[model samples]
Target: MLHTVNKSPFDSHSLQTCLGLAKAGSDILLIEDAVYAAMSGTAVTSMVESAMNSSTIYALEPDLKARGIGSEKMISGINLVGYDGFVELAVTNDKVQSWL
Candidate 1:
């Protein structure tokens, strides 16, 4: 568990209530503005690509380049960390939930 959505699935449902309570292998990151739901075609991008078939999404590469959102507009298996890979995924994820 390491869910850390920073809001803005088009202005927050807190990333659809943290992807409906996240459970399977959870590790979603998506920092500030929730990295716009890891991009790729908006409107929640197919619910963050179907929660990446049971969670492992990440995005924080400097908050997607300060919202310019590069990485080819993300979403192909999401995962783009940086701040030391978000402190190595909050120190290898024992728990880090922060949906707000």
Candidate 2:
């Protein structure tokens, strides 16, 4: 399963949902302003850890940089994937859910 968190409430809630499922290959994508959710030691950060520890997680690099978040400061387990990676996720995942 995979989820994209594009809004704040959904970002928080969807992450919580993913945590419970803890699927072997679950993924959470933080894009748009959701990229800012990667700052260390926040709700989003904890969520990032929870999802990544159990499955794959990624951030949209262009969105992060566009918002002034450099790639170096990204949270651990949160890889910076370009458009190609995003497309790959879409193609590879069994299911994709958008949290907006």
Candidate 3:
């Protein structure tokens, strides 16, 4: 399964809720303002990092760039993907759940 979150963790609980419900081995894609959660040293960093133990966490590269977040600011092991990569993930996963 693939879970996409587009809300900022600081502004919404959508990312946290998605993380809690996403099954092990699922793919979690952080898009839009949700990309903030993929950065290191944030309040949600530890949570996101812990989720990586059981799931693959990805952040949309374009979104990160738009938010002025460079790769160096991102947490290690969190994959950065482009629109094409996002499409590939959606196509590869059997299901996609969007957390607004």
Question: Which structure among the candidates has the greatest lDDT?
Answer: 3
Candidate 2 positional error at 5, Å: 1.0
* Tens digits of per-residue lDDT for model 2, 1-100: 6677765433356545645665677777877877777666565677666567677778888888888887566677677788898888888888788765
Using TM-score as the measure, the top candidate is 3
Tell me the tens digit of each residue's lDDT in model 1 across 4-70: 8888788768888888999988888888888888888878799889989998998988878988988
Stretch of 10 with least lDDT, candidate 1: 7-16
Q: Can you list the residue pairs that collide in candidate 3?
A: none
TM-score for each predicted model, relative to the true structure: 0.33, 0.78, 0.98
Off by over 4 Å in 3: none
lDDT of 2: 0.71
Clashes of 3: 0
Better of 1 and 2 by TM-score: 2
lDDT of each: 0.86, 0.71, 0.95
TM-score order of candidates, best first? Answer: 3, 2, 1
User: 1-100, model 3: which lDDT tens digit per residue?
Assistant: 9999999999999998998999999999999999999899988899999999999999999999999999889899999899999999999999999998
Better of 1 and 3 by TM-score: 3
User: What is the C-alpha local distance difference test score of candidate 3?
Assistant: 0.95
Q: Distance (Å) between predicted and true CA of 80, model 1?
A: 9.8
